[model samples]
Structure formats: structure tokens, C-alpha cells
Target chain A: MRLVQGNEAVVLGALAGGCNFYAGYPITPATEIMEQMARVLPARGGVFIQMEDELAALGAVIGAAWGGMRAMTATSGPGFSLMQEHIGYAAMTQTPCVIVDSQRVGPSTGQPTMPAQGDVMQARWGSHGDRPAIVVTASSVKDAYQMTQLSFEWADTYRLPVIVLLDAVLSHMRENVELPPAPPPFSRTLSPDVDVEKPFGNHPFVPFAETTRTIVTGLAHDETGATRGTVGHASEKIIRDAFNRLNHDYAAITQYREYRLEDAAWAVVSYGITARAARAAVDILRGEGMRVGLLELISLWPFPEPTVQSLARQVQGILMPELNLGQLILPLRAAVEGICPVAGLGRADGELFTPEEIANAMTSHSTHAERRVSHHA
Target chain B: MPKMGEDLHQYLRQQMMPTVWCPGCGHGNIARAIATALEHLGTDLGQVAILGGIGCSGRTPFYFNTNAMHTTHGRVLAFATGLKLANPRLTVITAMGDGDALAIGAGHFIHAARRNIDLTVILYNNSIYGMTGGQQAPTTPFNFRSTTSPFGNIEPTFDTVDLALAAGATYVARTTTFDFAEMPEYILGAIRHPGFAVVEILSQCPTYFGRLNKLGDPPDMLEYERNHTIVADEESVISRDELLGNLPVGVFRQEIRPEYTHQYADLCQARGGAYRA
Candidate 1:
């Protein structure tokens, strides 16, 4: 175990995951990732480029991904917004890459040094069009390191950009993390063969192979990678298939942790740094003998629908503690609307939700803590 | 230069016939010259990737039977930079248009040249956004009438060759579709250059630029090119600096600069790593 910041852990983890190309533009809470990449990437026999802007950063990352390299970029809120264009492009082209957003407060560069989870919804739907999104949130330095590597695996396996969402609080926090002793989890980046001929049965996915002349475009394209102009007919189906390809394994792809939630009446649904407080808040509620629990969601997109719905049946109410103005609550409410009453405990004051604050919010917002579980059908 | 013996038409996607471009658009001539240039250089099509932006010129990649990427508007150079760095052996040919390169993607254009990365960039200077119905491009000459500029364009034009040279491109040249026989040579020279190489082709847009500006048919547009542009030769003293909105068709700059990817490879080697970017 060694002491490392969440941002430093992300750099170490991405390199371990066989990331060969890194293109990034500096932003606070994420610049360390770029600086470390620039320092060590060349020595490790990889490419590190500081692009003109966040738009070009993601663009170059997508291009390197097409070249069959495990490429990535790191940025904060403003940079993430700039990246939405190429994020949409990466989705349309079905190129695999990893993007780490060490999120800070923002409608637009809201508070550079402060922490806020305002980009939770943006990560899922920032880019225009109905594109596929795989977003995973890291709650600690360990989670940040582990998920950064897992992000690469998921990006390649799903053939889409995997966003590892981090907030300013977690990014700056230091912790003792035990990194893997081996070359790390993602060993596949070395082979650099996506095998589109057998797997995707498409040429557009492979950029360098000679046997299949690849053609990648952002427009709605037919199976031949030719532009179909309109988004209807065969090309529409192609786009649809590409967009929801990861949904088939939604349950598997979407992950969450149950913190003493096996037996509870009221629960808190939270993720990232807020989830840390929620976990502590759950322990506080249990001490008060309130029969409350915590459900820490890891994968924000491909949301754990079945798990959240199952929890709603067992619990009478759920309090969603978030750093934003209740972004994830919309999905949480939809999951448990008819079964139970759900409330949002939001804090976007560029600070984290304390344990006592979360506990107080849960109890005050709880709709009749004594309500029977029999209220559910 | 004894012409390369083998026929390069094998690299053309003959199966994908009926190009999307309208009739009399000079884009087709420039594309043919590119194919001929590839043939002249004996570049293996399999190892070549034709990357393009969103415009009439952007569609050039789909016609080539090589590895191609049709990217977003004005972002072809950004993609090409990454693609070339990822696979240093693969020759990346960037195809972009006037508005795509000089307007929306102008930042990437200068930066790619500033890096001096190895790329064969073909800028199709049509002076109009034909794909979007002939809006005025950055290269549109003064007093020109476009769909967007109904009366007359009062804005000055961009000298593409000068911009390229100023951006630190190792090889900068300009040609015209009217100079059809000699156009391939410029493209061939760009392909052979080891660093950032740019070839701006003054392609005519008869469909829009011709119709709106009363430049007549495609033949008349060719005549305009023959009358307006000066060909650079040993006797010529005019520099691209004094373009004054008129086209200058010739090689403008060629220098010995350290190519980005190759320098990176040397860095990796010095660091004792086997991989070369």
C-alpha cells in the first residue's frame, strides 16, 4: 500500500491498463493526470500529446483508438463539455477509448477547486443524439485506481468510450491504495487486435488492417460504412444497434455495493463522494435504530434498475443524497415511483455532504419512518 | 521522373460508383490527381489512410479503397495527427476544404503544422461550402457572391499557402484543377515530404460559385483559373505573401525540420523502450 492522490492513482492505473496514447488539455483537478502522462508516457514507450483544446483532445483520443491503441484523456467540467462533440463522434463510430473527468463544480467552470457532482447527468446525456454511454463513478482513491483500469476493459469490450467520473473532492483526497502487483487487470491493450472481422463483423472498427478497408464516419451509416444521409431505414437500425449494444448486459455492466442494506426500512441511494457520506449516514441511522441502509451506485449509466427497484420493495422510502441538484434522483424516482416515496438530499455549495448532514436530511425527508413494508404490492 | 509502371486504379473503390459530388465540380479532378500521385509514389494503398472533414472534399475518403476516416467538420487534422502517431508506418492523407480547414478547424490546422507532424494534407480550396449550399468560405475572394453573400463578399480572402508556411509546415504548395497535368506533381511532392506537408488545390465549384458569381460553366471557371493565377517558375519573382486575394500556383516552401513522430520514436529509444510512436 502507498499514499497517492485520486488523480495520481488514475494516471498509474491507466498506464497499467496498457494505455499507449494519451491526448489531454489541462484543467484543474485533472491537470495532474496530464502532467504525469507527459512525464512518464514516453519513457514507457507510449505517446503523450497536449492538444489545442478539449475538443481536439478527445478527437485525437478517438483517432488513436481507431488505430487499435488504448488511448485516453483527462479533464474537468469545462473540458468535459468541450469533449461532448467527439464523445458523440466516438459513439457514432463505435470506437473504444477511456475518458476520465475529474469533475469540479460547474454550470460552466462553476468552482475550479471545489467539489460538486453536477456532471452526473451530463456524463450520460451530454452529447447530442441518442448515443451509448458507459459511466462509472469512483468514490475513493482505491476505487479511482481500480475503476480507471476497469474503464479501459469495458471501453474495449463494449467498443465505446467509457467515462470514469471523478469529482474534485475524491480527486484531491489522498489515501493508501494497494495497486496490483502484476501488469494490472487490462492486459489486452498490448495485443492491439480488436478482431472486427470475427467479433463486430465490420470493417469500420479496424483502422489499420489491410484485409478490411475501414471507413469511419459520424453520420448515420449503413453496414458498409457508407453515409445513408437520412437517419431512417437500415441505417437507423444500425445506429440503434450501436447505441444500445451495452444494454444487453445492463445488469452485469451496472454495479453497486450494499452497505448493511440486507435488512432496512429506509435507504439512501447515492454515488461518488456523496455515497461515502451516505455510507456513514447509514451507520448513524442504524445506531439510532431507524432500520435504514445505503446503496452506493458505481455505474451511473446503464443504471442498476433491477437492484434499485428491488430495494424500493424492501424499503418504505429512499433519500437520494447528491452533490448536484438531484440529477440521479430522476432515474431513482422513476425506478421506485409507484412502490415508495423518494426524496432528494442535494448539496451543490462546492463542498461535500457531511455524515451528520446526510443523516439529518434522511430522517427529516423520510415519509413516515414507521410506515409498514406491507404498503408495497 | 519515369512514371510508376503499375496502374493505381486498383486502389479506387470502383464498386462504390456514382460519387455524391455534382457534375462539373472540380473536386473529382483533384481526387483523380491524388490517386495518380499515390500511383506515382508507389505508396501501398493498404498502408494509407485517407482522413477527411465534413464537406465536398470530406467525401474523398469514401471513394478511396484505402483505410479511411470521414470525421466531423474541420477536425480531420486532429484525427490524422493521432492516427499517424499511433501507427507511425501508416501514411495519413488529410482531405479538407476551405471552410473546414480555415474556419471551424483553423486551430487544429495551425497546431498540426506547428508540431511538424508527418501528414499529407490536401486542402481543397473551392472558396465555397458546396456541401452546405455555397456559403462563403474563408478563402472566398473579395467581391465574390455566395449564397450567404448575395450582394458581394466584402471580406478579404485567406492565402492558404501563406497560412501553411506561417504555420511551420515543412512543405507548402498550391495548384489548380486547371493545371491538371501538373497538379499530381504537387500532391506527389507532398506525399514524399517527411514532415507536415500541405497542398492547397484551387478547385472550382461550378454548381454554386459559378452559378451565383456568374463565372459561367466549369469550363469558364477553368478559364478564370488560367487567367488569374500565376505559375511559379525560375523567372518568377512573386511570393505568396503578395497574393492580394489572387491565387499563386506553385511550391512555396520546403524545409528540413524534425518530424514529430520520428523525434518521439528517438525519445522512446533513448529512454530504452522498445515501442516507437
Candidate 2:
């Protein structure tokens, strides 16, 4: 156990997760991740590269992954936007790599120094085309440490780019984080029956390598890694299979925590730094005997629909407090499907929501719900 | 039964026959030159990785039997950089079209040269975006007409060989597809060079650059290259303008520099860290 910043925790977590190659361009809130990697990765016999831009950073990470190395890149909003094209490529090629997006306020480089959950939607759908995205958000230094390690495992297991979305506040904030004992370095399992001449034999998780002679391309390819562009059902089958691989393992991929949800009527749904305040708000509301609980989302994509649906049946209303203007609430509403009313308490002025604010929102939301029910009756 | 180079079947993926290049496209010649160069060098096919950017030239990697990756448009070199750095033993060769190499991917081109990474860049300079239906490319000759430049092009063209040399490519050479016999030797030289090597092949795009510019058939373009190009010698100093116009063909620069991967490994070892083999 040691005190560490969120960005520092990411570095420690990545090392523990067996990341051997890191390529990145220095951007604020994420530069420390690159700097730390540069200082430590080489000593650990790993490769650390400061690429010319974020495009090259992700591009290199994809190539390193194919070259039989666990690789990653870190960048903030503008840099993250630049990486979207290759992120699609990584997704298409089924490349196992981690992309750490320490998000700041942006449509374009809006506050770089302040915290915002602006990239939640971007992390899910920033890349073009229909593709499966595995995005996880971290709320504290501990979650940052553990989630970064889990991000690699998810990426390797699924053979796709896994995004660790960290907001500016959590990224810069420091706290005492207990680092777990490092696990054995994880490598993608190659099939024993894989033909050297034609690798990628029937296994979806197999990574490309020099020995494999596998041709990794952005064009839709079959299990053998050959380009099959809309020719038959092959392209469609491959894309569907890529999605199915994640969908089939939804139980393992979806991660979240319920704080005081049992016997609660109102819930605050939040993620990243906003979740920190939500947790506190849950405590404050519970102290007042308001029966308010919190649903802290750890996995942002695959949306934790089942859990949200179940929670919807238990709660009268849900208040989603986020740093951005109600991105996660939209999906939460769909998941709840009007069984329970969902309200968004969003702020994008580079300020985090306080416990008092969240507690007030929860009170107001439940009051409105009660009034609406009485009026209908 | 295969065609004339049936013996070279070992280097090619026989199943991926009937390539996407148009008839008389110089990309085929460039691809053949690559195959010949690897054969000449007796390079272990398994130890080679052919990377290609998106374009007509980007499809080159699919024909090869080695570890290949047809990457996104204008990003093959970036991918190759990572692959080479991760496993320095693999001989990395990148193929990119004129626009792929110089237009969108120009930043990577210059930076890769500056880093002096050991990769052979086979730039197929066709002067037009052949794959995307005859758009003007970075290497499109001044006043050359294309789909985008239907009127005469007002933009000045890039002398890629000069650009490569200026950007610190340790080995820089230019050859036309017409010089088929000599093209392989230049490619072989690039492959053998220990630092960043660029072999720009002046490939003719008969379907696009040729027809739009009224340069006749593929043979006519080849004739134009033969007539206009002058081989630079030690005795004469060729001006940039003349070199650009006449397409000065030959090895323009060669230097020894510390290769990036080797230096990185040495740095790690010097720091008492185990260098990744």
C-alpha cells in the first residue's frame, strides 16, 4: 500500500498487468502516465515511446500488440479524438491494446486542467462503424489502480481495445492506494493446433505475431485474418462474432458496485469522480433516513443494463449526477424504461458535484416522483 | 502451372491471385521488384513483415507470404515502427502510395526518418491517388490534371527523394518502374541498409495519371521516364529543380547512423535492465 495519484496508479497497474510496450504523446493529465512509463518501463525490459502524435501512439500500440506484446497509450481529450480512427482499426483488427483517455472538458480543447465526464459517449461511440467497445471508468486512486490492471485483462481476453476513461479530477487527485501483488504476466493463449502457415486457426482471442504470419487488416477478415470485404456472409459473420464474443461474456465484462441499494427507494447513479460525491451523498441521505443509495458504474459501456433494470424495479427514482450534461442518464433512462423516473444532475463548468448538491437532487427527485404519483391517483 | 517466375511461388500467396491492380499499372512492377529483391537477398520469408498503407500500393502486402498488415490509410510506417521496435529481428518493409506516404502520412514519414529506424520504405510514387479514382496526390507533377485538379494543378509537387534525404533517411534512392532490371537492386540495397532507407519507385498510373495527362500508354510513360531522367554522378552537382523535373534516378544519399531499436536496447542494457531479445 502506497499513496499515489490516479495517473501514477495507472502506471503501477499497467506494470502489474504485464504491459511491456507503451507508446504515447504527452498531453496534460495523461503526460504523467507517459513520463512514468518512460522512467520505469525500460528498466522492466519494456518499451516506452513518445510518439509524434496520438494517432501514432495508438497506431504503434496496435502494431506492438500484433508483435506479441501487451501495449497501451495514454492521452487526453484532443489527443483521444485524434486516436479515434486507429481505435476503429484496432477494433476492426481485433487488436488487444489499452487506451487510457484522461478526459478533460472538450468538444475541442475546452478546459484542459479541469475535470469533466465529457468523453463518456465518445468512449462508447467515438470510433466510426458498428463495433464492440469495452470502456471502464475509475472513480478514485484505488479504482484507477485496479481498473487499469483489469482493462488489460479485458483487452487481452476479448482481443479488442479497452478504454480506461479517467476524468481530470481523479487523474490528478492523490490518495492512499493499496497495490495488489503483481500477477504473472498475461499473454494471449495460442492454440496448440494452430498451423504456422495459417495462424488464427478458429480462435478469436489469438493475437497476431511474426511466427503466426497472420495478416492483420482493418478490412473485415475471417478467423484466418484474410480480408473478406462484403463478399459473402464472412464479413458479416466476423463482425457479429466480434460482438458476440463480448456479449457472451457479459457477466465477466460488466462490473459495478451497489452502495446501500438494499431497501432503498431513491438511487444516485454516477461514475468516475462524480461517483465519489454520489457515495458521500448516499451516506448523507441515509443519515437523514431518506433511504437513498448509490449505483456506482465501473464499466461505462455494455451500460450495465441488466443491473440498472433490476435497480429500476427496486427504486422509485434515480438521480444521475455527472460532470457532463447528462450523458449516462440517457442510457439509464432506456434501461429503466419508465418503470422508475430517472433525473440527471449534470454540471460541465469544471466543478465536481458536492455531497450536499447530490443529496438535494435526490430529495427533489423523490419529492417530484411522489407528487406525480399522487396527482395520477 | 504458374507464369514465368513460377520458382518465386514460395514468396507469394498463391491463393491471393488476380491482384487488384489495373492492367499496365506500375504497382505490379514495384511489387515484382520487391519479390525479386527478397529473393536476391535470400531473406527468410518467415522473418519478414510487409506492411502497407491504404491505396493501390497498400494491397502489396496481401500478395506476399510473410507476416503482413494492410494498415489504415497513411499510417503503415507508424505501425511498422512499433512492430520493429517490439521485435527488432523482423525485417520490416512498408509499401505506400504517393498520397499515402506524403499527404496524410507525411508527418510519420519525416519522423520515422529522423528516428533512423531500420525499415525499408518502398514508396510507389504514381503521382495520383490511383485507388480513389484519379485524385491529385502530393507527388502529382505541377500542372498535371486529375479528377480533383480537372483544370491544371496550381500546387507545386514534392520531390520525395529530396524530402527523404532532408528528413535524415540514411539511404535514399529513386528508380522508375521502367528500370525493372535495376529496381530490385535498389530495393535490395534499401533492405540491407542498417538505418532508415527509402526507395521511391516512379510508378506509372496509366489508368489515371497517364490518360488525364495524355501521356499515352504504359510504354509511353516508361519512354518519358527514360528520356527525361538523368543519373546523378559524383562529378556533377544536380540542382533541385533539374532533379525534380528530370526525375534523377539513383542512390542520392547513404549514411551510417545509430539505428533506433539497437540504441534503445543498448540504453536498457547500460541501465542494468534486461534488454528484450
The number of the candidate with the highest TM-score is: 2
Best by DockQ: 1
Q: What docking grade does candidate 1 earn? A: medium
The list of candidate 2 runs beyond 4 A from truth reads A181-191, A195-204, A207-211, A228-232, B1-6, B233-244
User: What is the overall TM-score of model 1 with all chains considered together?
Assistant: 0.94
lDDT of each: 0.84, 0.86
Per-residue lDDT of candidate 1, residues B1-277 (tens digit): 4353257568688755678888999999988888888887776787899999999999999889888899999998888988888888888999999999999999999999999999999999989999999899888888889988898899988888879888999999888899887678888888889999999998889999999999999999999998788876334687666645456678888888999998888888887655564
Q: Which candidate comes out best when scored by lDDT?
A: 2
What lDDT score goes with residue A236 in model 1? 64
Model 2: colliding residue pairs: none
Q: How badly does each model clash, as a count of residue pairs?
A: 0, 0
